[model samples]
Target: MDMSHIPDLITPAIPVFVITIIAEALWVKRQRAEAGVTLKGHTWKDTLASISMGLGSVAVGVGWKVVAFAGYAGLYHLTPLRMGSGPWAWVLLFFLEDLCYYAFHRVHHESRLFWASHVVHHSSQHYNLSTAVRQTWTPMTGWVFWVPLALLGFSPEMIVTQQAVSLLYQYWIHTEAIHRLPRPVEWLFNTPSHHRAHHASNAVYLDTNYAGILIIWDRLFGTFTPEVERPVYGLTKNLSTYNPVRIAFHEFAAIARDVARPGPLGQRLGYVFRNPAWKPKTAQAPEAPPPVEAAHPSP
Candidate 1:
């Protein structure tokens, strides 16, 4: 397998990121001045944090590519899934990747280890196209989640290509500008409405809609929720500061604190990997009620 093409995978992501930022700035200015909607403008700290996350994503991709190449060289072959050669293959790969992503995403929310990285993405209180760029600095550690695809004999190139396409397909779905699409499309693909529900902090909305390009996985797995009611975006405990360092390391620091508590070995380990909301009995605090509608606007 030629490792040279690995750089190309990341190159396309750059333009998409740039274009999305440009569009977001123009839209945000309009949204704040004309519409009644309040825009959560960026601080330099958040911007730097977002850039750091992007760099982390690139690093993860590079590492994954190395693993993929080794897998191909030793056990598999490099066969690119050609676009336009077969529609069925494309459909199959699309749904398969979505299923994989669904499982990966759900576990990220459920498991503290994964959420430590994913939480950075959700630290933003606002939901806009730019929020999509606020990616994770720790997804590389979760690369094991995609090993099933390689075991199933997907060529390294095909796997990477399909994964890239799936991510690219998701970029446009990060906006509040577009509401519900046509019913048929909404039923099949994930749109802004579905993503908004995923990003929502509402009790009923958390850990829902863990799809990528296709939402069928969420529907099949019973994690799908409709966007009939508007969503309240961000985490349960919103981080008030726009400091990138705080945003990136908050969950990690919390995990460390939890792990430092007096407990049995198993319990101590569980505190770090069980779930983001997990609390040891001694350290447990009162559960706060979900934020009321009066406090925040619905997406």
Candidate 2:
């Protein structure tokens, strides 16, 4: 089936996103004011930086999507198996698509190469609705992760539609205002509380709660962690600049430098594929010289 007619799900929601951001910013401001707090949910400079990154992401993604959609469609045609677009099929696609996302999201955190792109969203020091828009400019390659869905007999439309849905569901969860919902709701879905832990750089929360729409995937896969307290948002070593280009490609450049360093092929590859925090092993520190001479002990 031709996937050209699949209306861009994200583009139409831009207005709603702008409105909701304004509303959430006001609410967060009022809440902090009433409580007499100094830190803000929406800072002028940070929000502007986030907006710049968001626009850059959209601009870059436009050209890339043409190639990506064609690839998805090409793969869909090769698969002999066909999944009909029925109500039950949509339900099945929901779980399958989210599971794909769970894998995509988790790997982006696990491997430094992918994390270079994924880290753009996590670059924010503040968790607000605007943070949701602070997407990666280098996300052109992310479509690779969802190619399996096309091969699994779903049309490009089905896969793209659900991917957009998962993304939309995640937007509201980026805020700090909602906190936890009812216990059952929190258990079933990816709540603000769970996502807060995901965004946190604290050691305990590192690499946890990687979810798109459902928290069940994280729980099932042993990556889930609850928000125990307020999270320290951003990377473990936060970026010092808000320049969109640096925010987008800093880690990629870091990987290049690490790979260029004098090392074995394996160690250099590790810099690309290993954890972002990974480093080559170093020699242990020499033990202090026998606690001085035996004559010194007598004194």
Candidate 3:
């Protein structure tokens, strides 16, 4: 199988993504109109912001592809282990690539440096199909995660294309239009229900269900959290702007600020390597002298 010609599955899927997003928007609008239903349906500005971010990501990814292929091909040549280019190879790549995605997704959420890129997708407060296209400007971090597959004998082409397939498969799961599937399917796959929980900023939902295609990885890794209530989507401290530049670079600027603060080197590094929610303890001023207590603190 000549895998080099496996055209990007995502670029061609844009029209489908558009049509379905419009349909989901209308459906969600109607659903929200129903009695006792209170969905914060798609906002035009938010959707446009997502589209802008998606376009920026593609613009940057065009150049990144060469780096990715070269990185993978270089590794492939270093090893003698070669899996035959057959259907089985693709099947194996599918499962292995997903596990790689699980690791990539989990780490991006847990670490501030990576989260600075992945956060673009979750920047929207609305959970609609448009959110699926909200890609990152720094997608370079994503491909390197799968380079290990090349050393295991899969072609560089196969490694790249399979990653797109996993991403394309995940697009539809971003919509709130579809609810839960059958129990068995829900148990095995990453459904909208599961992904909704993953997108949620609710305390219980934070850092859970990091699956790309299969939910099994999250289940086995103890990151799975079922969606019980409708999720409150977006960051715990949501952004106030719709500017694409700000959306793409906000967290990075935040990391720069945190790292620049006067502190121990390890504490500064923590701002980059630690959880996005992690904060350094502030120095406390010594308590007022007992003599001052007689006057009581002025309000």
Summed backbone clashes in each candidate are: 0, 0, 0
Residues 65-107, model 1: lDDT tens digits:
6765575434444433233326676676666767888888899
Most lDDT-accurate candidate: 3
* TM-score to true structure, per model: 0.82, 0.92, 0.91
Order of candidate numbers by lDDT, starting with the best: 3, 2, 1
TM-score of 2: 0.92
The C-alpha stretches of model 1 lying farther than 4 A from their native spots are: 37-48, 68-88, 285-299
C-alpha RMSD in Å of predicted model 2 compared with the true structure: 3.1
Best by TM-score: 2
Between prediction 1 and prediction 3, the one with superior TM-score is 3
Predictions: Cα RMSD each: 8.7, 3.1, 4.9
TM value for model 3: 0.91
The total of clashing pairs for model 3 equals 0
Q: In candidate 2, where is summed lDDT lowest over 10 consecutive residues?
A: 290-299
Candidates ranked by TM-score: 2, 3, 1
lDDT of each: 0.74, 0.86, 0.88
- How many clashes show up in model 1? 0
Candidate 2, which segments miss by more than 4 Å at Cα?
1-4, 37-40, 283-299
